[model samples]
Target: MTTTARRGRPRGEGTDARILEAAHELLLERGYDGYSIDEVAQRAGVAKTTLYRRWPTKDHLIVAVVAKIQDDVPVTDTGNIRHDLVTYLEAIVAGLDRMRRVGRGREPGDRSAGLVAEIVAAAARHPDVGQAVRAVFARRNALPLALLESARARGDLNPDARPDVIFDELAGAVYYRLLITGEPFGGDYASRLVDQVLAGARTPSPRAERS
Candidate 1:
């Protein structure tokens, strides 16, 4: 059988996959500002109408790609909040490490960072992207929340401690170090964050400290 004839059996399946793949690659390459639907269609080797039939708009297509790449944060009941938090943060740091690899060798102020920032900004304006991003964070936090709750129940966390605020602080530190400060993301940094949070959560009473 000919190549076209053999593969033609799937009909629109191949075209749809191509469109999605093309959109993903172009979005990462050109970002929101530089990407266009027509360009995507051309890259995918499909008609403009075919691309539109699958995704009405570029925003919709980007959202779909983001959803497809969204990953579940792993949860582990390691019996120690510090260990669990460290593990969770390490997973996040690993993701950033991957991004750094992807962004390497690119020009200064290039599309890699610009693309991520644009997508985040766009998510603020687009309800579909916002919802999808929200869902991703929600799922990501499940394990951390469980670890926090377990710590509180075990009297490890401060009685007035707020897990949401704590998690945000921890994440903020890591993000600042990785994205802003250009500091290395490593096990030591993760361990330090866990220690910092734990120190803050320690009971302030001298007696509690002695115990």
Candidate 2:
């Protein structure tokens, strides 16, 4: 008698989610330094081969966990570009804050980048991880980029306003503060950031206005 072996990922199983959930918990508990891929598989109740088949490496698993968390943040295009972008960015800031605090114990006035920095360093250290990181960001960034395009199409933004550039500027500001300046993303930062970027993006040139 001949029997066929099981196929890819099994049928209708929540294995992916289970692994990601376990990874997320372990990452928060141990951070990058202490995080163990083997332990994640055990906690996820999945065979080591199953987890390895999906993520292959710790960096890949970590990136997948980050990507999964990112999907929870919604991007709503309410037609008001300023308000929409502000709201979207504020959600992003909240996500970043959670990542920034991951694995770091409570301390008075803590400002370190924590897990955020670890992910970055991991990407830099491994070429495959770097590629995965870029791919995740590229896929995840499309919604906001599309939102900017819609704004431009609706004349809510200057025709010269480049969505990619605008997005980079907006993203860069917060990242720079977090990674370089150690500035807080609290208070009116999200609103202020939106207003500042929109100041340049919203107004068309005099010639454009006349036309």
Candidate 3:
């Protein structure tokens, strides 16, 4: 049996954008604990009911903010697989580092993950939040995966190379450092990671070697 679809008024893009922007700003300022739905409504100039209609909980709003942050990261494919991967990985590293600093007054060498840890914990505690978080990562990571596949198709990478495996190695290392090891990852580290991944997965072409 099929159920009838219920239709309602379409939400305005402008309102959604404003709410997300307010939420993101507040998340960076107060982190997950201090982030208040009332404050977000006030900042966005939206009604509490209206905000709730869009995001039923603060966790949902925060996850949406994370999704927006991931969307803001650009994935470039300039035909140079190594350079492109390195650029994209560096961007991810920069974004993670920024997230690690949210709501914290720590120094440059701070190992604490800050708001990132909060996001991870929230996602872990709630299945819906966890699913949303995974969806955002999958959506964002598809770009790089496609890039790797394209490189493989163009003979730049080894025939036996798996894009998923390579990406896990690259991205996983950064996340592991952020979530588990509490180590800092920078652009230089991203560059080296890309080099290592490509060196193993890429073909023995002079062009690949040059990268």
lDDT values of the candidates? 0.71, 0.80, 0.83
Tens-digit lDDT string for candidate 1 (127-188): 87778767766776776887898888888888778888888888888767655666666568
Off by over 4 Å in 3: 1-18, 21-36, 43-45, 203-211
TM-score: model 2 vs. ground truth: 0.80
Candidate 3 local lDDT, residue 3: 17
> Which of the numbered candidates is closest to the native, going by highest lDDT?
3
Worst ten in a row by lDDT for model 3: 1-10
Q: What is the alpha-carbon lDDT for the whole of candidate 1?
A: 0.71
TM-score for each of the candidates: 0.69, 0.80, 0.78
Instruction: Report the C-alpha displacement of residue 48, candidate 2, in angstroms.
Output: 2.0
The runs of at least 3 residues in candidate 1 whose Cα sits more than 4 Å from the true structure, single-residue gaps closed, are 1-22, 37-57, 64-72, 107-115, 125-127, 205-211
Cα lDDT tens digits, model 3, 100-170, are: 77553667777877667777877887788889898888988999999999999999998888899999999
What would you estimate as the lDDT of candidate 3? 0.83
Q: How many residue pairs clash in each candidate at the backbone level?
A: 0, 0, 0
Best by TM-score: 2
TM-score of 1: 0.69
